[model samples]
Target: MKIQRRTVNSSTDQVLDSDPVIDRIYKGRNAQSKDEFDYALAQLLPYHLLKGIDACCSWLYDAFKAQDRICIIGDYDVDGATSTTVMLKGLAGLGFTDVCYMIPNRIKDGYGLTPALVDRAISMQAQRIITVDNGIVSYQGVDYANANGVSVLITDHHMAAEKLPEAVVVNPNQLDCTFPSKTLAGVGVAYYVLIAFRAYLRDQGHDLRFNLLELIDIVALGTVADCVPLDKNNRLLVHHGLKRMRSGQVSHGIAALLSIAKRNPKLLASDDLGFAVAPRLNAAGRLDDMSIGVQCLMSDSAQEAHSYAQTLDSINLTRREIQANMLDEAQKSLETVDVKNEKIAIVYGEKWHEGIIGLVASMLKETHNIPAIAMANDSDNTILKGSCRSIPGLNIRDVLVDFDLQHPGVLIKFGGHAMAAGLSLNASRLTDFTEGMRALIQEKVTDDMLQKCILVDGPLPQSHRNLPFARLLLTKGPWGQCFEKPVFDDVFTLESVRKVGQAHLKLSVRDSEQQYDAIWFFCPESWFAVRAKQVRLIYALSINDFNGKRSVQLMVQHAQVVESLPIVS
Candidate 1:
């Protein structure tokens, strides 16, 4: 991709701290440093509120003392798989052999703890069951386990409902949770629980030789993959994880994944995990079976991991093709309606796959800049399975709750966080539900929230477009939701623009002082309407490593030519 370069004033003046609004928004919290680790640990919430950690550790300690059966109930997603692997490896290090793990098939068991899964655990004669990445809302499943005389410990990061399950719950979002960082991903929370468990074991005179921190690699993978905000504690977890991964201490499965994605282990970044590795891990859960993913993580042999990675890679390709076809059909359906006039956009099709509804909803939100919901007819029972993606100002779950109150007995079940949600409803009620959602959104949404603006960080100088600077940005990041990767604005004189890859813009740009290359992916041709003389650009700095040679490149996000007005002097 060719990136256009522009020259701007090289002003190094720092903004004064007296600006309160800017300070609050731009510099909310300074990035964490290594020196803050000890202080962070000291300030962490008490061990008891962490939920399943203490209980699970205590049970494991007793099991070690008495030699009883232990099994881990693992979820199928990236977070679930990584957390399970970490627990299994950590327990094995502590000389536990009776420990085993079970990952439910996405198609067969759906999500979280279920009665069927509980029966499977019972069949293994498991004395204690520890759940990873799920089970906070599994009230019935937890009750079933308890009735069967199996102790259950739940460790999850999803939003909790009004009432929680009876199992020892260790979620940061719990009603009475006092954890400073409420944004910890499931794996990060699981890692913290493990730390607490190790501490308890050490206090009891157990010989746990391996440092618990080594598991940060798995924690980082899950945290990034789950799209958790990179807050203070999460940054530390990911930072340590990236360090270990770069040092070649990560698991063989992760190494194989990186290899398949053509990513260098030593040059791993959070983006690599999110865009490259995470999707492959998620593909198993999305299309085929999550057991493939969990097994890949649990694999000790490099050959076995590589084989699973290949299977995941193939599945991911198929997923992308399916997603593209669904998105195209959804966009066509959207074009026939005036979504801009409505507060919320709801669309459905019998052809849309239930497995990819969430992704389609996300794409619709991006395309229309509104909270969008997409539903698909489930072939099994003719039920409407839908997913919603909301904008920053909209609380999708609350919206659904309002809709539920308006039309009682319409929605079968729904639950999710502020930005996204999922639900099941009768196929016959689709039109009424869609109209209700649109009406509710119209009442709540404002005009200013409709226009989509690309937020850019500080402006960039032409001098900063070099390999060293690109490397600096890459290495200095564990960037995610809150702490976004930097995007710089520059005024470039477009020398020429050409089409590439069907819908991409390949541009050659130059300023008064220098010239640069850039590319804008999937941007429309209408972008050229801006006068080329004073075109403005917003882009992220990246390093292009090809054939063992590295150079700087810009990935354009948005561009607009400046509109000149009549001079009034």
Candidate 2:
């Protein structure tokens, strides 16, 4: 692994509001001024700038005025769940009482708006169908709805296809659209649609008193959970959402989820949304029906929210167990192939759980520092479903696209973002698919791109290596994806090293002028077998709590022995 620090300009004196170190970190992340970091709703771009939004708003207004039955076609992930909930809540507040939602089962309907989903909506006598989080690429489903006298409004954020459906599409990624932030999560797009619709209603002399800002909690959760880039617009959404949650002014569902996850709403952070809440909500979609998850998110009664949250929590535990077993099985299967020499890994099993293959793929990608695909038998034993995960430089979806183009008729279907993708293929074509994918990845991934890189915000000065600095950094962020928590790399002399509860390593280390406690979670036993006194470490500053006391601690990310270091026992 390589360690490097980001560069920042020295002319940021007038723009920063705090410690010079924090200012440097912010500038290194491309923050032009302190205003860019502000979470005020006024910082968001006007909804009018979003292409197709005005048209969507007008269409929805006309439909609602006529009391048209509406159905929201949602995907099954966290983004889809929150998008559906936000749209449903916002629509209800806008006097659309007949609105309903339907999310496809992951194992049954696959992804996006299928013709079957349209049929279900039609059966419900829906006059208008709006797709949230999915439908930008759902040409056939959109056409099906249009043919059946139903208007389809697509509010998606995924990359669009060339031949788009003949519906009003509000995706920022569309070719002609110039929406400033293309990284809006599905929920963000839905919220913008409501904002535009509210404006249109006001023009029509309808006096509606809907507080759309209250829906920011779900918007924030979905945005962070989806792993989207934390651009200015997204950051603003999360910031307000966190504020609402911390102040106990959030929805019953959010409060319930926080309780089940053992996270105090008063101390909520973006990290909790990703690590605690999202997994439980996503587990329902991964293991069963996302409708249940949506029910929890859409709940208004505290009692009902708690009941649904407990059920989801139980499912998330099952998800973890299944993932762990599948990972173990996958590692055992790797013995058949030379994983060390392979540019990419494609592992499969006859009965591997399809729901957990994506998690397995992610684990393999991070452990091996290579692109990986984990495949399992589909419901039809003749076809195999595969989940793929890629490294930074390799766009897994594009690679799959090129592979499909090169070898037609092999891939059943595939679509996802740059780092992850999903597909199915005939069971017999597994060999061909693996070989073809490996060739394509080898052609694109350069040597430098293949190597793992650990980035740092330079070394922390002794003066700033205290609990106060750690606490200050925590307040400045709901960080994830593009906006990451600050980490630093420095040389330290090891004073002690010992194994903790499971696989973690506890250490006491000293730098030039300070001694600090540190911990490395999930450390391999072999890493401590040949311990060295002087080590180069990449770590993040953290406030460690023990016995009702808090102190500065370092959570080590990577560690290596320094050259010419003598073992001092």
**C-alpha local distance difference test of each model:** 0.78, 0.88
Candidate 2: tens digits of C-alpha lDDT, residues 1-569:
87778877666566575687888788878777888877777889888889888789888988888989999989899999999999999999999979988999998898888789999999999999999999988889888888888899999999887768889899998888888999999999999999989889999999989999989999999999999999888988998999899889989888999999877676677988998999999999999999988999888799999999999999999999999889988989887877656778788988788888999999999988889999999887999999999999889999988999999999998888799999999999999998898788778888887788887899888889998788677678878889987888888898888888868999899988889999999886776654677888899887776655778899999988784445678
The collision pairs in model 2 are none
TM-score for candidate 2: 0.94
lDDT minimum window of 10 residues, candidate 1: 1-10
Query: What does the lDDT read for residue 62 in candidate 1?
Result: 77
lDDT for model 2 comes to 0.88
Error of 1 at 201 (Å): 1.7
Over 521-555, each residue of candidate 1 has an lDDT whose tens digit, in order, gives 88967864333556677888777667787666678
